[model samples]
Target: MSQTTARSAPSKSDIAVVPPRRPSPWRDRLSRLDVKASPYLYIAPFFLVFGVVGLFPLLYTGYVSLFDWELGDDNPVFIGFDNYVELFGDDQFYKTLTNTVSIFLLSSGPQIVIAVLLAALLNARLRMPTAWRVGVLLPYAASLVAIGIIFANLFGPNYGLVNSVFELLGLDRVDWQANRFASHIAIAIMVNWRWTGYNALIILAAMKAIPREIYEAAWVDGASPMRRFFSITLPLLRPTLIFVVVTSTIGGLQIFTEPKLFDAMPGSNNGGSTNQFQTVTLYMYQTAFEGQHFGYASATAWVLFLVILVIASLNFLLTRRLVR
Candidate 1:
C-alpha cells in the first residue's frame, strides 16, 4: 500500500492517435508533371521549329494577303480586298482551279486504291520482305525533278515511248500537254508513280499494327483474304487511311513540281504552252514571280488555303461518318 506509484490522469493527447495527412491534389499533379517532363522536353524542339518557320510563315502570308506586297519592296501598299476582287474576275484562276480539282481527284483516287493493294501485297508472306519494303521506297528517294522530266519525255508529242506503244496498238498518239484531259491524266500518272509506294508504306505500317489475333479469328471463321481485308483490316485502318487522305490532299493542292516540269521545256513557269496543265500552284508561281504580282498571288494563296481547309474538314467529317 505504501509503495503505490502516482498515476497520470487520462489526457486526450495521450489517448488520441494522429493520422498521416494525404497529399493535396496540386502536389499530386505536380509530381505527375515531373514524371512527364522528359517527354515534353524531347518534343519541345519540333514544336518550336514548326511554330517559328511553318506557323509564322503561314500567319505572315495571311497578313500580306490583306495588303499589296510587292517583291523587292519594303513598303507594302495597303490595298484592302482589291487583290481578292481581281482573283474572282480572272478567267485563268477558274481554269487553274478546275484543273487542280480534276488532277486531285484523278491522282488521289487511284493513288489510295493502288497504295492499299500494294500494302496488302507487302504484308503477305513473301521472300525478302525487307528488300521489298526498301525497294518500294526507292521512288521516294529519287529526284522529283528527274521524275517530272522523264515523264514529260515518256508522254511527249512524238517519238516518246508511250506514243510509240500506242502506235503499235493501232491507237493515235495523244498529245498530253496539248489537251486538258490528257494533260491532267499525265500529271496524275506522275503523281501516282512518285507517291504510291510511299503511301503504301504508310498504310503498311498501319496494317502491321493491327492484331494478328483479329485476322486469325476472321480466318478461323472461313473468311477469305479479301473478305478479311474488307471487314477487319479496312475498319481498323480507317484512322490511318484518313490521315493519309488528308496529307495527300494537302500535297495534291501544292501540285507545282510535276505539272510545272511536265511542260515541253522544264521550268517554263507556265504550266504548258497553252496553260492546259496549269494547276493552282503553277498559277500562283507565275503570278508571284513571273508576272511579278505578289499581292494577287497572296490573294490566290488565301483562296486555295481556304479551299484546302474546307476540303480537309469535309474529308475528316465524311471519313468519320463512313467509318462509323
Candidate 2:
C-alpha cells in the first residue's frame, strides 16, 4: 500500500454524527395542558351548585324527617322513623294520598288526551295559524295566582257567572267549594284550562317534525285521515305523548294554587269546608307552616317524592313498550 492511499482511507472513529430530536409542538402542548383535568375543571361548577342547592336540601329534609322537628321550636328530638310510622297510621295522610291520586287521574288524564287531540288539530292546515298558537299558549304563560282567583270567582256559589247561568236555566245552583265532587271538578277544569294549551303546543311541535313522506305514503296506500292518525301519527308521537303524560302527572300530583285559593274564603282554608279539595302538596303546606309539624310534613314530602318516582318509572317503561 502506498502512503497516500493509507492517508486517504478513513479511520474507525471517523463516523457521521446525528443531532438528537426535539419534542413535537403538539406533544409539548398536550403535556403542558391536560385534557382530563380541563374537563373536570369545566364540570366542577355544576357539581358544586347541585351539591349546595339540590342535594343538600334533599339530604337535610330526610334528616329532619327522622327527628321530631316543629316550626318555632327551640329543640328537635330524634324519633327514628316514628314520623313515618305515625304518618302511615294517620287518616289525614290517607285522605291526602287519595285526593292527590284522584286529582292527578282526573286532571292529567283528560288534559293529556284533550291536549293531544287539540295538538293534532292545530298541526293541520288552518287560517291565522300563528295567532291560534299564540292564543293557546297565553293561558300557560298567565300567572297561577291569577288563574286561581279567576276560577274561584267563576265557581263561587253566589254572584258567580256559573251559578248565574244555572239560575237562568232554572237549574239548581251548585255549591262548588262545599261539595267534594264539585270542588274536584272545578280544580280539574282550572288545571285543564291552564296546561292543555302548553301540552298541545308541545305535541303539535312533535307532530310537525314527523316526516311528510310518511303521511304521503300512508295516503298513497288509501289510508283515511282518521286511520292515518290512529295508525301512523299516534305511533310516531308516542314519545311526545309520554313526555306530556309524565309532566302532567308531576304537575297534577303537586297541585297547590287552585285548591289553596279556592279554600281561602271564609270557613274554607282546610282545603274546603270539609277538606275535600286538599291535595298532598297543600296538605304538606298546611302541616309544615300552618300546623307547625315540620317532621311530619317532611315525611309527607318524601312520600310524595316516591310516588312521583314510581309514576315516572312506570311512564318510561310504558313508553319503551309503545316504542317497541
Candidate 3:
C-alpha cells in the first residue's frame, strides 16, 4: 500500500495535475476599472478646463449685465432690464447696429465671391503653390492694429495715397470719413483686404479635398471651367463656404480697431463725424471706457452676442438647406 501511494503521489506529472491558480480579485477589479475608465480619465481635463474658464465667466457676464454698475462706483444698483431698455431707446445703439450689419453684409458678400474665385484659381496645378498660399495668408497674419494704422494713413482726406491716386486720375477725392456711408466703405475695404485671402485659403483646402475624378468626369463631358465651378465645386464646397460666411459675419460685426483708428483723427470722436462707422463693439468700448457705464457696456455685449448667435444659426440653417 505504501509503494502504491508513492507511485501515485511522488510522480512529477501527478504533482503538476493541481488546478491552475485563480486570478486575485483585487487585480481583476483593477484591470477592469483601467479598461473602463482610461478613456474618461484622458478626456476629463477638457471638461474641467472649460467649466472653469469658459462656462463660469459666461454665466458671470450674463449676471453682471442686469445692473447699474459704473467703473468707479462702489455700489452696483440692481436694475433689471433697465440697461437693456435704455440701450433700445438710445439712438447710438441703433446706429451702431445698423453700421455693424451693413459692414458685415458689404464685406462678407464680396469676400465670399472673391474668395471663391481666388480659391478656384489656387486649386489648379501650379508651380510654387505653397509659397503662393503663404503669400495670400500674409495679411491675415499681420496685426489688426497695424492694419488699422496703415489704412488710416491711406484713407486720409488730404495727402493720402487713395486721394493722391484719385487726383492723378482727375477723379474726385472721396471723403472717406465724412459720413456714415463712406466710413462703412472704408471699414469694409480694410476688412475685405485682411480677410479675403484667409477665406480663400480655407476654401482652397476644401476644394483640394474634392476627388479629382469628379473634375475629370466633368471635363470629359465638355464642361467649361465656370460650369464645373458652379455645378461641382460650389456644391461640394458649400459647407466650407458657410463656415467662412459665419466667421466673417462675426468678425465684421465686432469690427473695432479699423473704424476706431479711422475716426481717431481730429474732430472724429465716436467713430467719424456722424458715428457712421461705429460698430457695436466700438460702442461698447466707448461706453465702458469713455462713458464709464460698465453695466450698459456689458448689456451691449450680451446683445451683440445674441445677434451673432442668431445670425450664425440662420447661416447654419441655410447651409443645411443647401446641402440637402
Q: Give every collision pair in model 3.
A: none
lDDT of 2 at 268: 40
Off by over 4 Å in 1: 1-44
Candidate 2 ranges with C-alpha deviation above 4 Å:
1-34, 264-269, 319-324
lDDT of 1 by residue, 193-308 (tens): 98999999999999999999999998999999889988998889899989988999888887999988888875687788777889998999998898877888989998999999
Lowest lDDT block of 10, candidate 1: 1-10
lDDT values for all models: 0.88, 0.85, 0.86
Give the better candidate number (1 or 2) by TM-score.
Answer: 2
Model 2: per-residue Cα lDDT over 46-127, one tens digit each: 9999999998988899998998999977899999999999999988878878877877778888888898899888988899
Clashes (N, CA, C under 3 Å) per candidate = 0, 0, 0
Worst 10 residues of 2 by lDDT: 11-20
Q: Is candidate 1 or candidate 2 better by lDDT?
A: 1
Question: What is the C-alpha lDDT profile of model 3 across 118-189, one tens digit per residue?
Answer: 988888888999999998899999998889889988988877899999999999988887866777888899
* lDDT of residue 179 for candidate 1: 86
User: How far out, in Å, is residue 15 in model 2?
Assistant: 19
